[model samples]
Target chain A: MRFNDKLRLAWKKNNSLVCVGLDPDLSRLPAGMAQQRESIFEFNKTIIDATHDVVCAYKPQIAYFSAYSAEEQLEQTIQYIKTHYPDIPVILDSKRGDIGSTAQKYAVEAFERYQADAVTINPYMGFDSAEPFLNYQDRGVILLCRTSNRGAGDIQDLIVDGVPLYERVADLVANQWNKHNNCLLVVGATWPEQMAKIRNIVGDMPFLVPGAGAQGGDVEQLVKAGKTADGTGLIVNSSRGVLYASNGPDFVEAARNEVIKLRDLINQFR
Target chain B: MRFNDKLRLAWKKNNSLVCVGLDPDLSRLPAGMAQQRESIFEFNKTIIDATHDVVCAYKPQIAYFSAYSAEEQLEQTIQYIKTHYPDIPVILDSKRGDIGSTAQKYAVEAFERYQADAVTINPYMGFDSAEPFLNYQDRGVILLCRTSNRGAGDIQDLIVDGVPLYERVADLVANQWNKHNNCLLVVGATWPEQMAKIRNIVGDMPFLVPGAGAQGGDVEQLVKAGKTADGTGLIVNSSRGVLYASNGPDFVEAARNEVIKLRDLINQFR
Candidate 1:
């Protein structure tokens, strides 16, 4: 199934908009397991088993795995998710971009190797970096529109032809690049007003809204301002707040409770 | 030694600006050897052995290695270059960027795992993505400014503060991000005017100029417009024109000849 349709199904089936970011910092992993690669896979498996029913998707930040030289473990983690939670879509939050052939290889790495349902891309190289990801008709390509970082406005807020650079990026992605209906924008929940402007520009396209809980973004405002007319177009991600809710043995249960709280809060806003 | 000083030492020792890109496409590999990961490493060994003396740096585009799931071979290739040709620097062309924590992991991936002297990064996320790489006081952080691709102008050409987005990027990289003196800019040789403008913005700072030969970039114009006042500070890259110069057994010699030609052409302009 195309990622958009698959996302819709997952969204409705779970009746949730929470996307748990699986960014396993080794220091934060619970005690007893050696910091080996398999330990990460084990931790991810536990997290997925605990929270799959409450999430619309699982977004794995590739850097966490690559940091430990654990791409193999990451592969296994994704496989575990796919096998156990077949209904949940996996979005590899790589944000990789390059020229033509290199982008093609990255596309292969994300889609074919990791079997992600979608991937994020950086658009700094213009269409050359994004076209290869977009060519994957079944996978979604989430472009980093207005990032959640503190200094995201250094370039993204630069004015261009009476529009900010991020808005221009949204316009380009909407009018030019979303031909396959597989394009998504990443608008941080930290900037709910900007998210609303971006939503207006991109219309009903889904926004992978990071920075909801741990990053102190007002989830109520995000759901009220950034949600689509159907109330199911925002994937509100909370990484540390959910994953590291309690690093004790109750970590999985804490994660479950956190996701339930975030989901209910989003639904109340909707 | 810091990356900028190391780059200068290598540039002067070799008296050349050619950065041979090791983008080994399996389909384009020479016959007579099985297309395996080891063969890819062997091919890189030959190319590095053949052209190490006439070049300032070796840039192994990570996508080429990741395409074959041969990051191990890539690690070995960098180790091989460091062992045999310690004077020459290796720029791993990753173009990676993410938030603060993720950026920290990617920095480890490039500098610790791959041991690249330098790595490319996308600057769209503002400082959050590039700052971690910059914090490596001795390693180089080359940011994408004006790319060589045909569609590079999509967002980069958008006017911000009456200057193009790329120039603004150049200004920001020079003024705000180069406090550690480890920052470099990537201005494509394909756009000599933009290259000259960026050079003027970032005076005396090094520029990794790709798109030289097969990308239809003018080598002489790049050397004349991009070089520092001392006739150095440009790392001109040519991938296909050098790596795929010959698909026969004489591939090594052909690659050496191509590098020599590019280096001499650059020197002549200087």
Candidate 2:
């Protein structure tokens, strides 16, 4: 199935749009699991088990796993999710961009090696960097438009022909780059006004909205600005806020509670 | 020593500006080694051994390793160079960029996990994305400015303030972003005019120039446009042309010869 259809099914079945970012920081891991060889996968398994039914998607930040030489754990985490909760899609939030040949290898890393349902890419390299991933046809290629960070405006807001660069990116992705229907924009929840403008530009194209909880993005404003006409076009993400809600034994349950709260809050606005 | 001083020392010691890219494609490996478990490392070892003296740097594209779950091989490759030929810097051509917290993890993945002396980054996310890497005061952070690929102009050529975006990137990296003196710009050899323009903007800042050999970039044009006033601020890279110069057992010698030829040709222009 196409990533869009799979995502929509997940949204309907779970009645949510929350995406839990599995960024397992070793220093912040629970006391007992930090020293274990397979701690990342083990912790992720617990979180996925607890929140699988409550959330629409899982986004594993590749940096956290790669930082500790835990690519094996990342593979295990994704495999565990596919085996146990096949309905929920996984987005590998890699934000990778390169020239054509190098970008092809990255595509293999995200799709074949990791077996992610969708992957986020940086649009800085332009179309060839994105073309290899879009060739997957079914996988989602989420391009960073206006990121959730404070310094996102450094390049994203550069005015070109009287419109911000991010708006041009939105128009280009929606009109020219979405020929395969596999492209999506990353319009951060922290910038609701920009999100609304992007929504206007791209119509009902899905958005992978980061910066909800830990990044101080208000759920009400995000939903109001980013929702499609049918009210289901956003995958709202919360990483540290949801993953490390508690550092103790109840971390798994705390994570689940946070996901539920975020899902319900987003739905309330929708 | 800082990356700039180390790079200049390599240039003076080796009398070369060549940076041989270590992008090992599985299908393109020499006939016998393709099926071996340690082929990536073994191949890189031979290439590095043969060309290390003729080159100023070694750039291992991480995607080539990570795609085949060969991160350990990448680690071995960089470690081999550091142990045996410490003067020749290793640039991890990752092209990574993300928000601040996530970017920190990527910095660890490059500088800590791989122990690369320098790493390439995509500048689309702006200053904060480049900050964590710069915090490693001794390491080199190369940002993408004008890429070699034909589609580089898709977003890079977008006019902002009556100048192309790549020029703006060059100005920013040369002035504001180089406070740590750890930043370099990636200017492709495929476009000499743009490279000359970037040279005007950035003055004598170093450039990691790709697309020389297999990518059909001319050595003379690249050197004329990109060299600093002192003629030593460029690391010209050739990947497939040097690495896979021959499919036979003479591949190692062929690689060395190609590197010598490229080095001499670049010096001729200088």
Candidate 3:
């Protein structure tokens, strides 16, 4: 299935807009969860099992896996998700950008090798850096725009022509690069006004909204500003808030509870 | 030993300005080589052995290794380089960027897991995205500036205020971020004028200039425009032109010959 089709199906079936991030920091893992690949995989497996129904997608940050040389564990975790929760697509959050040749290898790494349904890319180098990912006609390529951090305005908010850089990015992606119809934009939920502006520019292309949880974004405002007419155009991601909910033995349950609450809150807004 | 110190030592010792990219594409590998991690490592070993004397640094693009699930081979290759060619710093060409927490993981991946001396990063998300990589006071954090590709100007050349965006990036990196003296910038050999302009802006900062060979960038102009007063500010990289010099069994020798020609050409211009 195409990435958007699968995402639409998952959204309808689960009635959710939550994208749980599988970012496992060694220092932040539960007590007794030693810094090993096996523990990380096990923790991910438990979290996946607990929150599958509440999630529209699973976004695994590549840095967490690459940090420990736990790529095998990451692969296995994706496979486990595919085998068990087949409808929930896996988005590998690797903001990779390079020239054409290097971008091709990254495409292989994200799509063929890791079997992720979608991937994130940085748009600094413009079309060439994102072309390889967009060539995957069945996959989704999410580009960073209006990111959710303090210093994001340093460059992203730079005025070009008459509009900010992020709006220019949205215009470029919406008008120029969405030929394949598989492109998405990442607008942080913390900037609801910008997200609303971007939503107007991009029409209905899904926005992978981060910063809805520990990053201190208001979920209701984000949903109100970012949702499409059908109320299915946002993937509100909560990584630390969901994954590290409780360091105790009931961490999985706590994560499940947190995702359930976030999903319901998003649905109520929808 | 700091990264720049090691790079300077190698540049002076070898009297060369070539950075050979280890972008081993599986389809481009020599015939009869089995598709296994061991074979990949062996191919890299042969290539490194042949080009170590002629090149100043060995840049292994992370995408190529990650594509074939050969990250172990990448690890082993870096270890081999450290043991065998200690002075030649290994720059992991992973243009990684993310938010603060995710960026932290990427820093761990580049420094702790791979143990690379330097790394390439994308600055699209602004300062916070580059902050985690910059926090590594000992290692080098090379930011992407004017890229070598054709469409690099789509966003990079967009004029803001009165200057182009890339010059603005140079200003930011030079004035704000190089406090630890571990910052570098990427300027494409394809745009020698821009390279020279950037060179003038950031007086002595090292420029990782790609697009020398296969990308049709002129070597003499690049060397002349990119070199510092001491003739040691440009690390011109040629990947496919060196690696795919010949598809025959004499590939290593052919690669060495190509790199030698590039190194001598750069030195002649110097």
**Model 2, range A180-238, lDDT digits (tens) per residue?**
99999998999999999999999889999999988899889999999998889999998
For model 1 chain B, the run of ten residues with the poorest summed lDDT: B29-38
The weakest ten consecutive residues by lDDT in model 2 chain B span: B29-38
True contacts kept of each: 0.80, 0.81, 0.88
Could you give candidate 3's per-residue lDDT for residues A137-187 as a string of tens digits?
A: 999999998899988898888889989999999999999999999999999
Candidate 3's displacement at residue B206, Å, is 0.3
Consecutive 10-residue window with the lowest summed lDDT within model 3 chain A? A29-38
User: What's the DockQ for every one of the candidates?
Assistant: 0.84, 0.87, 0.86
- Deviating ranges (above 4 Å) for candidate 1: none
lDDT of 2 by residue, B113-228 (tens): 89999999998888999999999999999999999887899899999999999999999888899999999999989999999999998877899999998889988888999899
lDDT by candidate, in order shown:
0.91, 0.93, 0.91
How should the candidates be ordered by lDDT, best one leading? 2, 3, 1
- For model 1 the local lDDT of residue A221 reads 89
lDDT of 3 at B144: 93
